[model samples]
Target chain A: MNESWDEIGQLFKNARSIVILSHVRPDGDAYGSSLGLAWTLRALGKEVLVCNEDGMARSYRFLPGSEEVVSTPKTAPQGCDIVIAVDTSTQERLGPTFALWNRKVDINLDHHASNTCYGTWNLIDPLAPASALVCYKLLQALGWTCPKEAASCFYVGLLTDTNAFRFCPLSPDVFRMAAELVEQGADPLSLSEGAYRNYSIGQFHLLREILAQTVFAWENRVAYYRLTPALLKQTGAENTEVENFLTYLQKVSTVQVAFMLEELEPNLTRVSLRSRAPIDVCQIAQRFGGGGHPRASGIRARIPMAEMEKLLLEEIRQVLQ
Target chain B: MNESWDEIGQLFKNARSIVILSHVRPDGDAYGSSLGLAWTLRALGKEVLVCNEDGMARSYRFLPGSEEVVSTPKTAPQGCDIVIAVDTSTQERLGPTFALWNRKVDINLDHHASNTCYGTWNLIDPLAPASALVCYKLLQALGWTCPKEAASCFYVGLLTDTNAFRFCPLSPDVFRMAAELVEQGADPLSLSEGAYRNYSIGQFHLLREILAQTVFAWENRVAYYRLTPALLKQTGAENTEVENFLTYLQKVSTVQVAFMLEELEPNLTRVSLRSRAPIDVCQIAQRFGGGGHPRASGIRARIPMAEMEKLLLEEIRQVLQ
Candidate 1:
């Protein structure tokens, strides 16, 4: 059910023990929203537990209350009066944690338009720049002040989800919320440093190798890079470190479409696509049984890396033409 | 003399024609502030002319009213009743344009801590994130709303000056002002795309070459790169395109100090230095007759590229120790 902020506030206020869960392989938003809500609840003298299927990434360990988040619940789900999912778009996104707790989710807080709303009460604002902003607004609606730790966590969520305010259609409210969060002790520099600037030496090496191998096509309007397991092994960089390297290609002035062909296995390739405005990369990805937003999308092809590249390039060329 | 906002507002209100000037090698802030103030003054039914020594860079040509900014004044400066300098720190920084205007500057608006009170009415707020922001506050204090074009220009100034809000000590007021600017018609995505995302293909190639040749020292705590004229010719990139690539080295988690040795000439090497907190690169830069902030500095040595590299590495190693 689509519930109002007042209803959600009442539900939280009445609950003695609440458990928060986020998506698998949790990003800053997932951990940030979960921990932010946890900190706010604990400040209200309520028992709060935060959990994620994959736990926290090393980069986000500096966030307050990160140490308290558990991969597995120590207590029974039945003992908690409320089970709230934060930043998780669908029930399955909770991963293995969803199977462990079979009860109906009491609340679902999210900003994603794709949210399935499987909870008994759902608060989804697609206009919200980030899920953390939704949590901040919910606290405001309840006449409760966000704790300092919660403010920092929410700021991280806002910072990373928006690509440090680069990607989002930044609204007045987004900046206002950011301002209030800063006033409440959210350090933008430190949070951004911890989230974006912390790159390993191995990651740096991997970036170098990837850029060195970049190929441009169609009057330099399209750029693509191939990442192989051999390259990963040679650079000693994890796959996760390659998540944002496609941005390097996208930033090129003449490039309209930028993609990465990552060889996942002997005959399987995962392709990530990004394009500028007026070009829908999601349509290109959908042709290969994959999908995402208009500007950014992904596909997993059951073909060799070269074959996948050829097929994707043909599709992108048609769009460019 | 230092002037109050009301006094500056009255001076602008009374002026019939105003000439605005920015420093040499104009950046986003320089042009943004000049154009933003021009648009505001035009909206107030005042005749305004914006001039710069180097004119606007090709990248910032997308900004509103950019075409109006000229490298040389069309009419004599004496024809204008007021001469205002925006974002230019010192009087000499205004370059040859200062000599063109023999009259005393009526108003000097800036956010640089090193700004000299060169105007009859000077409003320098070092705490302000950008000079455009100071102009925004001045308009607000005069009960004037920022025009849409001016808002976009000011947004660019703030966005670029703060490195997309990454470098500034983001206080509540900064975000609040940004929120106001966005509400008044600053499209953040388009503005940021124009300001930062537009990198030439040659620039991308230069970045790739620079990364490929990166050298790490002191257990990866110090990373440096050499950019010779041959590399520039090979990549087909202009020297202007190499301004921000030092950030690539600074982002490595293990790197405390990152520098770039650019071979400006066969016997002249320009070295740019950047370091994290608790390390003062300005001191190191000062030893070579150059200076800047503690974290970011530069030096131009008449030494050859190889000799300059060796000497700078020795200085950096001592600091690292």
Candidate 2:
């Protein structure tokens, strides 16, 4: 990785115009590292362009340079000399129809252990908590001062990828980096509000309805909630708002497996699953032709909500056994 | 504060036995700093007896040395030559039966700006995020190595007092201290679970019920929820479980003020209030003879729930106006 980083640094040094790319449906870390690195490169007199298939998460709009992210890159910059992908594990994940004039990836900076090392130069550390941390270190190695704006972006990256610092992989180095960033003028409270606290009233209403109607099975070890069109209409919430609803269900201490069943259509239900230790939810999602990390996963099923719930419960029970 | 700290250090050096006391109904900082200081003192071969009017919060039972806290101290410990009060602004807040055999308070360490400086030697910094930070600095000033146990205690203090680092008091120093503590063996994941993640299944049920029945008024800016006795009875939730219910209410972006009205008696209701900036909830609670911080407060009213809601709404409206 050190040798690869040295090569990546050489690529960065040689590039006069660069485009930073991240995976589609970009998260805070995606935007954070891309924009953060873009700003750092720009500070060093390099022309930088940041592109993502999905512009930015709405909650993260307050982050610096978030508005400048190009969602659709129809024409690459005429003088574009390098393409650096960040927080992207796979090339296809960078989004369909995304290409820099058919140019190969010059540099890849990521934290996924499964990285394929497809780039000409790869600086990947799967053990890193977030790619933004890697970006900060790269900036230091490149001899660039981390501006407050870039620091805020990195802070958001760290805060969100760690689920507001509650997730695992929050090493001492991460905390120290956070402190240094904050000292450089990253407002943690405001960044926290932007990343985690900025929820619409409709989401709360929907959450409440779902929580009240939750069903517990297997001695309360399997908890699941259902959200139908009616509930969505009543609360005025969009489908995106349901992304984190399972977290509340997972909060139930006895719930080894928690899930949310959302009625995308009369016969189509979108299932989001979460599990604690001793249960692997991703496997269940994979069984249904979907996949994600071990603890969290999702799948869309062509079954009724009740039947799907029963099936999921049985599957989860088997996994527990 | 430095001169006072120096005197405080001298007292620590002179005393062979010390008893650390915090305010009644001790919080995480109280337990953390007391235990943290106690461990450091013990390592230095000084006898330390940590006492609290109320023992550690049940969630903090995972903290090392928490079991040694003497909740019902019939008398001060034998040979106790120094009494260091921590996280307590006033001496009376230490509890009704607390005293050092009629001796003067040898030292007072706190973070509250309103500290009365009631000790012979006072080291109070209202700007400090938590008393535990003060304790860490004191340990450094006294040249004591912070063992892993002490570090874990301090981490809990920092995590809880900052409300898991989302609160406004999280300065750069707090993060640095957290990093140092983690380096000394403080497990962030375990500490987080101990402080915020451990919730009973019944609490979730009760929370669900509250959210479903929430009442929104003032353009959904003033959202309040009611918790009836029947609901609590049905869910088997203790009254103390409702302490953090207002957090959900506060999550709504449009909600400028949020409160929970719980029935404490047939015609008596306890109202817990929370608000964002530009509104001082403490002032609102004061109108009903309750006092607390600007963001959170509470009051008990001897009126029916509906009438109390109306009255509180009017008061809040007037404040908004």
Candidate 3:
């Protein structure tokens, strides 16, 4: 009775409680997918629990069930019914809470190119933006009229993942799904502001700080900046601000390569690279066991902060040359 | 004999001198159109002169014939048989030399949307990028294959005016003409660097100065930055630096409306505004007698610089609210 999607819907109909979980370091797609799925499940007469390891980013407050996300263990009871994971491709990313359940049965949903098929009942499609888009379609298949809450959740996920379709990483099915979501009342202005307008005072100061320290590696047509922990503290900025600063650097005149190194610990570092031209920062990132697309990528290069900066700069120069 | 296309080609076939003049603010299109036209004419046995208003930005130094541009006139012999004015839709944009010529005796080609139909033999198709794209076709009309030099010239204009297709302010015909120019000998990579690379230290320093004075009209999501004459002087920055700073303010996280107020004079200010979303800054720019696109635009307003800043900021804020 629990094998197929029809069976899954029947399980939802029978279950009294549901908890939707997304990966840590939640992004637009991750956050959107979680909220959209939770909203849909709640509409199916299930008491839903949307849980994440970290807090929601300030920008996504407009999402329907975003505020309801419970990050602490105190909120969940012994049994959380059938747990559904969204946007998470691996168990480690679920991060330290895999034991929170008393071996509850789970359904995993995701849309990453490298899905690990982690859940007991895995439904991974690398083509969708957020699992929420897939979740939205599934609810439709189950004969659910997407309530306003569910619609808003899916809309937020679609909006953020696509950057209003500026740099869509999704397939054709994603946009067709997005169009249907918009027809059901997705406000483009609000969506744009929620995803793009969200920035903090410290983040803006961080931008100025890093930009001031920006070293244009003119010979390589590369530009880079670093955010040491001390510097981040000095500017009262976070790791995320370093991510946004690199976005601005990528647009510099004649600059095809951009790198930002953030101090994760006193000695360890995290590297984020973006290339506007044909250079492959992905392969560079993959050398450190991290992976991403050709245009955008990240790597957890666990070298001393100073050496990591030098290594990345020299590495990019050598590789691209 | 002077009216037929072949007669014009035959007339230039024996000419000892020809003056090549492009419009002021010689953009890629203007440079491409004129330079390509000149080389094609030169190859067909005409003595060609590429004259312009001033030294091009260093970013343009790699363009073909860029080094030979005549910013200041030296000596001119008796009149040549042909004078081609390119990317110059209006006589005023051609400056002092344009006023000295008789409209009935000169050949003009342009692609300005607001071209005033001001030439004796005007080829005004506002849809094209630089007059150079049209000039490429004219090379074919003159029964000449685009020589390398001619191809490079046209490449510069095409790269500049189209902003390398990042700013597609032209029609499809313009791109098709550009394709033919590339096939003729346009090296897009070198052309991309020559047109967009080669950033000067002064420009980068000026960029830093502009970021220092960034301010936000917070409630309406309008942010503006000041680039005072003092800032430019302190940094030893060129006017081109101000052009580079044009989009800086618009990129602020919460900024939907961005303005850069450059003090061209104590009472005169050049306001450049950019928008990421759909709020049209052009409507605000046009209200003040300036016109441009919705996303990117400019306005020249004369008032005390500070007052002009306040007034313009308030005016733009009204739109968002």
Cα TM-score of candidate 1: 0.93
1 or 2: which has the higher DockQ?
1
- Cα error, residue B242 of model 2, in Å, equals 2.4
Best by DockQ: 1
Q: How would you encode candidate 3's per-residue C-alpha lDDT over B106-215 as one tens digit per residue?
A: 67777665666665566665556566766776667777778987877886776565444432333434445555555666655455544554556566666665676677
TM-score of chain A of each: 0.91, 0.86, 0.87
Q: Model 1, DockQ value?
A: 0.77
Q: Tell me the TM-score of each prediction against the true structure.
A: 0.93, 0.89, 0.63
Per-prediction DockQ: 0.77, 0.64, 0.09
Q: Which ten residues in a row have the lowest lDDT in candidate 3 chain B?
A: B163-172
Ranking by lDDT: 1, 2, 3
Give the Å shift of residue B174 in candidate 2: 1.5
Off by over 4 Å in 3: A1-4, A72-76, A102-105, A129-132, A136-144, A163-173, A253-256, A276-282, A292-295, B1-208, B216-222, B228-257, B265-267, B273-298, B304-307, B310-321
Q: Which is better, 2 or 3, measured by DockQ?
A: 2
Clashing residue pairs in candidate 3 are: B28-B157, B29-B130, B32-B157, B33-B132
Compared with the true structure, what per-residue lDDT tens digits does model 2 show for residues B1-321? 634556666777888999999987677889999999898889889998988887666656778999898874767777889989999877877987785356577788888866789988888887778889988888887778998899989988887777677746467877888889999888887677566655678788788778877888998888888888899889877665586777777777778898998887889988889887768988999888766667777788788888988999999987762
